[model samples]
Target: MGPRPEYPRPALRRAEWQSLNGEWEFGAGDEPVFDRRIVVPFCPESELSGIGRRAGDVVWYRRWFDAPEAERLHLHFGAVDYRATVWVNDVEVARHEGGHSPFTADVTAAARTAENVLVVRAEDPLSDKTIPRGKQHWTETPEGIFYTATTGVWQSVWLEPLPALHVTRLSLVPDLRAGAVDFEVDPGTDFVVTLDGEVVGRSSGQPRGRLRLERVEPWHPDSPRLYGLEARLGQDRVETYFGLRTVEARDGRFWLNGEPFIQRLVL
Candidate 1:
């Protein structure tokens, strides 16, 4: 089995998707000459990459994949450390900075039906303290607190096929006090709210509204409860789940679900 085979995004899921995590042609520097192979989703500095050594500040990754059939295709990267520049079929698709945040690029225009080439260029300077290198040591060897540094693509990369005019985003804000949940769908499309496979509320031609629950279930650590949600826009459908709960501070104490609760810190 390939590494990290699970779906990259669980909260927002679709039935059709493809995982792009596996071995790829790898090399150090800005040039495209890949002289070695490395397992993707694992930085070259890690043992899992088959090359337990640093690949310098700049590295290149090249891989080929068969394109999926859809009106639109979105290439998603769970994360790439520091900076990343991607090209699909030799056409620049995305350029992103920041190591921890996920990003996506529309590759419908650059993807070919039979096959496509994916190239990634990652830049992560070791001596630069300005970049956010959380827990990563600057020197070659790890010290007391700082650990081994990671460079290049260190997270899952996948492809998802999407329809034209599909739902772009979905936001759910739970209001425990009002026994309802506020929802906002992009492009103002109709949506249906379901709880445990049963329809509870719905809206037509409205993007933002509130859906009151008939029986409220407060989520707790012992007995966690969640509600299933499905939103549809045109031919696109997305499935997600949410839990209802509330936390607040009162009288210098933490309160959970309107009851005073003790807090524990483990940092």
Candidate 2:
């Protein structure tokens, strides 16, 4: 869960994301504390924390960021524990339950220019039945392959800023034969695809502020091409990269890069 390189997960926009992954101050107030300082994203019970023990305690994390005045400041988490209550600048902003998926909260209203305190209170009732506890062993079995009970802040915590009116997402499909990629964008004003900050393709806009991507490249596998999208919507600009490739079936088999293929399943 450490700043997972893959973004636009579940398809929101990537260029609008800000990573809040790093050190965080933890408070094991009135809890059965274990050891000392712990790194973020990784659970307190894992070896990565540098303090590996069953410290299923509620932790507090604080950080600050400069948000665009026109941007909609958003807070996101890859995943939390059994239950988590998030507070932005000492104001409760989000409360989430369920340990399987992900969640987010917009803290624009409760934000200020000064320091912002992000406190997360987590609790896990050891015998949690409703949650999907995959690979996490809740019992007291210390070693052997199973693990100790890990509590709060078990995943990545981040902040993302969004443009007032922006392209939230884009979809691309590769046409191997054409050696280009097709596109579908939701740009509010205009969007230009770039690579390494160099403009490669662009889409125009209507006079009233609507943009549509009509002409585009057809992506092919051998080239393994991609288009870097830089869309300007008012004052906010979004950035993301899309691959031009397709997955298909041929003669009861899958094909990648327009070639006959055989998939592997080695376990």
What is the alpha-carbon lDDT of model 2 when measured against the actual structure?
0.64
**lDDT of residue 40 for candidate 2:** 73
What would the TM-score be for candidate 1 when compared with the true structure?
A: 0.93
* True-structure RMSD, every candidate: 1.7, 5.3
Clash pairs detected, candidate 1: none
Query: How much is the lDDT of residue 207 in candidate 2?
Result: 24
Backbone collision tally, model 2? 7
Q: In candidate 2, which residue pairs clash? A: 180-217, 180-218, 180-219, 181-217, 181-218, 181-219, 194-228
Clash count list over all predictions: 0, 7
Misplaced by over 4 Å in model 2 are 1-19, 28-36, 57-71, 98-100, 140-150, 161-187, 194-201, 205-223, 248-253, 262-267
For candidate 1, the lDDT comes to 0.89
Error of 1 at 260 (Å): 3.7
